[model samples]
Target: MATYDPFRDLDRLASSFLDTRRGPRRMPMDLYRDGDHYVLTADLPGIDPGSVDIDVDGQLLTIRAERTLSAGDGVKWITREREAASFLRQLNLGQGIDTERISASYDNGVLSVTIPVSEKAKPRKIAVSTASDSQVVQAHESGADEPQPIEQ
Candidate 1:
């Protein structure tokens, strides 16, 4: 009689499931703030640049792309698969964002977006003075002795 090990079988099943879930379906991105603009970058390889779309509605930002995998007329792929992808990322603009001036660019399999900050949100420079200009006067009595001039 052979004994069945449940732990060994569970581990193998979990590893296989994770492997199938990795690829273009789950793209990673990075967002950062640079000076007066916010930059967003994402990695999307083997995708047609013309098929990508970027949109901003209210405070939400969305990115989507579609790619069709096909083979030549004379050749055939043993396994043919078509990939369609979409990413939804919402950013809270709060009260100090200039959405009208936003710009975007794509290059080298990477997408970059620039969102400008509002004028009110930028830092301002203020000047300070350390000198006082108030005037003071003191009156002397009529009978007072001839005031002696003080030497400088």
Candidate 2:
């Protein structure tokens, strides 16, 4: 009791031809900003953790993983659909991202990357001085003998 889709098969065939030299395939990913850090998650199921590679060059982040299929001797294959393939994904981190503190982790067939925002890009509050402090600063700037009253 399985339904067949002709369009799905056709699309798969076309993709196989186009992706022959492009390695395994591009896995789906999600990128979102969480507070002061940006989080990126990618789906990479059935891939060995050791085979996963993450690299950051300039403002570009690259991720690669490989999936291998093994068969035992004298084993008869029936309905083999999963094939060995390499997965590659890249993302461009903009200027506000802190490249030095970028961290990545892989767990449960999912890869998560955390990118911190640069200190310079984060908003900061400026301290507002009292009226007396402003008056002192104004007196210092004017080089007056006594502290002058600050005009509103």
- TM-scores of all predicted structures: 0.59, 0.73
Top TM-score hit: 2
Instruction: Give candidate 1 misplaced runs (Cα > 4 Å).
Output: 1-26, 78-84, 126-152
- Model 2 local distance difference test score: 0.87
Q: What shift in Å separates residue 147 of candidate 1 from its native position after superposition?
A: 25
| Deviation of model 2 at 84, angstroms | 0.8
Candidate 1 local lDDT, 76-148, one digit each (tens)? 5674333444444445666677888878787988878788889998989987754453344455568876554
Q: Report, for every candidate in turn, its global Cα lDDT versus the true structure.
A: 0.70, 0.87
Could you give candidate 2's per-residue lDDT for residues 1-152 as a string of tens digits? 98988999899878866755644689899999899999999999999999999999999999999999998999998767677889999888879889999998999999999999999999899999876664323444466677765455
For candidate 1, the 10 contiguous residues with the lowest summed lDDT are 79-88
